[model samples]
Target: MSYGLFKKVHYTIPVEKINAVKLTQSLQARITGRYMAEVINVGMGDDGTDQKAFLVLYSSRNSMQNYLQMLLPEFSDILAAPAEKQPRVVWAAWLIPFSGYLVAIAAGLLTVLEFRPDFLKQTVIAAAGMTLLFLLSAVCRFFTAGVSVKEDYLILVRGYMRRSVICVSYDKIQHINTKQNFIAQKTGIQKGNLHLLASALNMTQSVPYFREEELDVIKSRMLKTSHAQ
Candidate 1:
């Protein structure tokens, strides 16, 4: 694969040396059913230790996957299974996350307007307009986000204006967790969180506005992989 601007970076890993072919749904390629294809190859680290090179394919979907499988038929089983993705995003699930922001904005606007009574009326109108726009944006973002699970990796695709597709290995995930408010519980909506490599990376990844059943599927796979590792 070759990719870069002025000077392109090329990669050619032998079929035997290929570690894994990860399929993720980035916002760009997600419009069509077909998505992004990634090639994970073995590389040498700065300290002369083994590392990984995640090379993204500019062209994607079944075509790329088929070519690779033709090169190595042994792992066809893994590639053949379609990526089981939870496409549904609960719009109501975003209410709690946005509540605090709305409150803060209201409070700030009130406080600022109190000091500037001369332009209070105009300021209020402007702030209200901007707030509505932001709220609309948040709604679009929540609705467009997606999450998927695969045998070797878990992919989280979030954000609307600036999308991000994070693919973390199941083995790296230390644990899986979920939280629900009274409303969330009643509605069967929960926010899922993933704690990965407790000692190495003290960070948690989230699957926002996820349905209970879909989240359960991801939780089961994540737990099984983490424990096995």
Candidate 2:
């Protein structure tokens, strides 16, 4: 096929009053054979509402033309305004893992000071090595983790040593849950879990520390999308 014959069409859908499941099904039915829809979670509203946005990428010109023809009548209500792309991880994510590392290093140094002052230099070196390892691992994970939303599907990318990208369709999602500890809550960071119907496995994704409002937006969107299909 000629490059000119294929054009990419992008749509950012806003999740609000519309039935997300129905909308996704309708779109999926139409584009199944003609084009692939790449969906991405563009992030949530700063206005502090449960507003969620999605970016859909269509690679086929015919499918794009067909979708555009029906978009206004079928999806305009769910169409969302453009949103700023959220960063992959926030600064607090960089700090949380190091908190434990800090505690461990402090305890080690104190033990050496009380019992073996002559080994202080060795303790410091060991502590520094441990700190460097923890920092490296945390930074790698922070950079590697990612989540993407698509029509009828959600994609989770995670890990550093054994990286994996999992694609789960909305239909296969049995439940969506969120968790936060007292410190996590205070820091505005939370973890989300997706329960899958097929293997009875839970896929977990962590949101780096962010505004509580933004977290709510992301959680709401996931729940809505999972339930919709």
Candidate 3:
């Protein structure tokens, strides 16, 4: 890729080093049927991760076609398997929030009965309402989230209201870490995160909530893939 107004700059990027491909469409671009894509590339150096960006053809037919051509074969599998309908660990979504809320409700119920007996009914109603909201969030998350390792990519899918799919190439991952807080430890919920070759975008691919064993599967797969590569 080469571009410049006065002094032309040329970039020779390996497909493997390309970490992210983001297409942006504005109101004008939508109507004009022309869009811009950001291609983020990363490489490892003796000092640290080196990241660079390329702005693909903007508002030009040739640029759009070039981007689509690069996008299709590169992420065909991920596109074929859409994130919105991916399978999820249903219980993992509700477990943490539900546990905390249950404890608070139990305490509130006891306090109201002992000190404010007159407000016990009202407290119960409020608790029920709050529980419903938490349940609704869990349902939404269950439908939105997924974590899968396919071929050489680690795909982390999650969001509510808007869907986000994070794609991380296995070769670029610098580290893999897992965490469990106090509540998470009690509830058997864990988080797994990948430290990829650093970039200004700080794009993270992770499984935010899951069972310990589920995270283990991802770790095992990643290690095997890395070693194989």
Candidate 4:
């Protein structure tokens, strides 16, 4: 299961100003060996105007890497940015939910001990086991989740039991939204959502507990790439 999760890598290329046909041909030529490629039309914009953007999906990470290597020189200015990982504070956000669970478990334990002395040992063991499991899961998730920005694509990496990568092209992005509650605002951590036009159903990629300033930079880069001729 872990092997399957790590096998795939998702990435994208921007073809807004470039010729899609030519770009596809170039990618195909460079991506040798066994691989599958599909071109998907992302549909019209919110204003009812035809959006010319296309999403190119590759079956494997090697194929995407080969394509990027071949295409990078031509679009260097647009794709020059390096990928960014989730900040340490992002992982700390898990403490909020963990704390809630801990509180509930403590209350339950207290109630049970007060009512029944026979169940005290069992209650204590169960609470300790649950707390350990939650902490482990939170730590694993915190280490695994991250975001990377390429020339034309924003890559979202998420995993716990199994990992998956979602690469959204700039032109295919319909909206970039950010939100922060009172606690999050105080900590300078925010949640971000990327709304995409390519999926038939409303699809969103979420980034939790990212630094607000970093998200703003990503949002700015995405906007600039989307508007590029």
Candidate 5:
């Protein structure tokens, strides 16, 4: 595959938009070839003129062809744009364990009111302990898992003590999984799962937090690399 295969895709968002600056920075550093940026629309208000710009990105035909090859495990096609995305674990996960804590509190109250049981205190303490454990687990899951793609290797980092990294050359990726549980689903947060051609020591570490559109961008880029190689 050659760079000529790619076709340009243009996207523009106002500077005031959340993550806009980050997106621009990533494009400048990570993307290859000719691009353009200019203020398209500016806000006129008492506050000030907000800088608004249009960004043009060129992706060769080869880039698009390569991207098609980097499919995820269960998905046949790459993701289309999803609106109003968010980072994984932004809030849904933090609140999941609290639901259990709420249940425990309700149970404790019921036990104390209906029966003057000494065990009620023990049960409440036990519930608290379990909730603490759940919270810790969520923290670990949030911090330890992520994906990083370099020129040739796509890296996944997972776990604390059971730490490991899996390096898959861009061409070998068989599939990618972007998933969310009921908690994450409701809140519009997602975690990514990358499945490759061959088994590695740790396959699970590739999961990463991503906003929906961000995930699509990554998948597209990885696929482009895979095919280009």
Candidate 6:
């Protein structure tokens, strides 16, 4: 069973009340990037019994406004942005194979320079192993992956070996993260996972090998899709 865990809750500053332009300008100056936020959802809680507004953000100025409108339908009828506008890359799955290929070629070269017949065998074996690994990784990449934009649900499937499928919905999504390790960066592969509200059923649906950038795109799409009404 898979579940989501709550990591953090970020409160928003009012757009009208704050100096939106000045704040944005400052952020741009300091970070050399544009900033945007979108209001996603709103409702009252036990503390204030007041409606809350949720928003999404983008570093790009134009994209931010568009995402906001998508999240808040009552505010606008325009489509702000696709759930996934920028995709993070996952390089490892792509890298491992290529790395394997390179190593095999290197081994062959070493064999030639050293005049050792065994180098050819070693290179062939290494190349074969790497090629197989790459093939398997790429194949596994698409196996059981699933995403639900309407229900704000996402499912990740890892087949066979330690295989697990995880399912998560927005209300229960605890965390969404993007990570790239040193090796993963070489191939541009980023991995992501979801922490969900804990429960026996959900624990069974937890995902293990999620592609990070793609997952965020799914999340963005779901949140925006939910507001279509």
Instruction: Evaluate all candidate structures by whole-model CA lDDT and list the values in order.
Output: 0.59, 0.47, 0.62, 0.56, 0.46, 0.42
- Model 2 scores a TM of 0.50
TM-score of each: 0.60, 0.50, 0.57, 0.61, 0.47, 0.36
Best by lDDT: 3
Screening candidate 2 with a backbone cut-off below 3 angstroms (N, C-alpha, C), the clashing residue pairs are 21-228, 39-149, 39-150
Residue 44 alpha-carbon offset, candidate 6, angstroms: 33
lDDT string, candidate 1, 1-229, tens digits: 5666896666676755543444555555666545455544334233343332435454455665675567545444443444333334354655665787788878877887778777777777887887798787876676556665666666666666544455566655667788888767878867677765322222456676556787666667767865776
Q: lDDT by residue for model 4 over 1-229, one digit each (tens)?
A: 0112555434354554332111222234334422222333344233454432333343354555565556434332222334355677664555677778989998999899889979999989988998888878777667656776655566665655444445556666677888876667777887778776553422466765567777766767767876784
RMSD, one per candidate, in order = 5.8, 13.6, 7.5, 9.7, 18.0, 18.1
Candidate 2 lDDT over 1-229, as tens digits, reads 1122375433344433222211222234333533333222323233455433322343354554455346424332222312122244444554655677698789889999999999999989988887788777767666655555544445555554434344544554556666666665666655666554321122233333334565445556666765665
Q: Evaluate model 4: give its TM-score.
A: 0.61
Give lDDT: candidate 4, residue 134.
85
**Winner by TM-score:** 4
Per-model tally of clashing residue pairs: 0, 3, 0, 2, 18, 38
Q: What is the lDDT of candidate 1?
A: 0.59
Residue 149 displacement (Å), model 5: 3.6
Local lDDT at 16 for model 1: 50
lDDT of 6 by residue, 1-229 (tens): 1122584555654432221110122323225545433222212132453422224333454564565455433333122212221122433454665676778777766766588665677666866786688667655444423332333444443442223223334544545666666766565445555544332222223344333455557667656645663
Give the least accurate 10-residue stretch of model 3, judged by summed lDDT: 43-52
Off by over 4 Å in 6: 1-116, 160-163, 179-190, 197-229
Q: What's the residue-level lDDT of 151 in candidate 1?
A: 61
Angstrom error of the Cα, residue 94, model 3: value is 4.3
Evaluated against the true structure, the overall lDDT of model 3 is: 0.62
10 residues in a row with least lDDT, candidate 1: 44-53
